[model samples]
Target: MARLALSAIVMMMAFIAFTEGLRGVGPKKCCFKFNDKPVLENKVVSYSRTSQRCSNPAILLNTVAGRQMCVRPSASWVKDLVTYLETKNVAGANSNL
Candidate 1:
């Protein structure tokens, strides 16, 4: 009886560990959206096309305050925002030169 109880406890522990491991295996879903929001403009410090952390193709924005936000790359507004930032950066550089 003691041996049966020990085997059952071990099986339960193994099952729990397996379930936890399964839960941790996938990337968590993100619900970020840029719709109806004002342009961040100069607030964006940097942007990236490729994201190693996100499961989907996301435009990752690093804000001036060091906060990170993920936006959908396929969104037209996101593309326009990136273009605006690039143009602003170029104009700023030209003024300095």
Candidate 2:
């Protein structure tokens, strides 16, 4: 349970880093790295909380935890990103999700 909760937090932070870009400082050219052999099987990329930050959307969709996290973006920042992304796709950026 603790692991899951921690994972969730990590995922959310990662989402914010990419989707919102760290306090409007702008995107940081990020990417998600994972080891899926246990469940994702796509561990080519490498990124841990301690690793450098990134802002690439491809990173989020490439893994299980990442995919879930990408579904969420900071509420305050989504409007701008969505506008930039040019889509009304706030399907997962909500707190309810």
Candidate 3:
């Protein structure tokens, strides 16, 4: 019985450590407001309405030196910007045809 108890304790400790390690491994949660620093329109690479893996919707943008930036989706300006980009992309594709 004492050996069994020791084995159980070890398993529980291992489970806790595993869970803690996982908690630190995923993407960092982020929230943004409209009044924050303006993201350049020309720098936007693409946008995703809702990232299934992310906690909230975000706009993907290319920042200085090719880094990516995730911006909040709730902003009206962000919506307009996405629409504009989509239309621009379509138009560009058509012109190439």
Which is the better candidate, 1 or 2, if ranked by TM-score?
A: 1
lDDT for every model? Answer: 0.74, 0.41, 0.69
- Give me the candidate number with maximum TM-score: 3
lDDT of 3 by residue, 2-93 (tens): 99999999999999999999997766644353234666677676655434566665666554467666666667777777787899889999
Question: Which residue runs of candidate 3 sit more than 4 Å off their true CA positions?
Answer: 1-35
lDDT of 1 by residue, 1-97 (tens): 9999999999999999999899976556443554345446878877766535555667767789997777776777788888887887899999998
* Candidate 2 TM-score, C-alpha based: 0.22
Q: Residues 12-61, candidate 2: write the lDDT tens digits.
A: 99998787655676453444543222223342122222213454333232
Q: How many backbone clashes does candidate 1 have?
A: 0
Query: What's every prediction's RMSD, in angstroms?
Result: 5.9, 18.8, 5.2
Candidate 1 residue pairs in clash (backbone atoms < 3 Å): none
Clashing pairs in 2: 30-54, 30-55, 33-45, 34-43, 36-40, 36-41, 37-41
